[model samples]
Target: MGAAEWMQARSPEQSLTARIVRWYSFLSATLVGG
Candidate 1:
């Protein structure tokens, strides 16, 4: 399956870790950017 399909296949609970990692990266980027 493609990325979109894979993402759609994932449940929110299963994707929580991914979401946290993404959020962490986003926060770190903002801090570093600023």
Candidate 2:
């Protein structure tokens, strides 16, 4: 999905854990690429 669409799709009620998981995965991918 487009960045804007994804940002808009994120609900305020979404759990913090979900965001943490996404952040972890993103960080892992960046580390692996580097």
Choose the strongest candidate by TM-score: 2
lDDT (10s digit) by residue, model 2, range 1-34: 4643463369446546566677688889999999
Report the poorest 10 consecutive residues by lDDT, candidate 2: 3-12
Question: Which residue pairs collide in model 2, if any?
Answer: none
TM-score per prediction, in order, is: 0.54, 0.56
Model 2 segments beyond 4 Å from truth?
Answer: 1-9
What's the lDDT for residue 6 in model 1?
A: 55
* Candidate 1, run of 10 with poorest lDDT: 3-12
In model 1, which runs have C-alpha deviations exceeding 4 angstroms? 1-14
lDDT of each: 0.67, 0.66
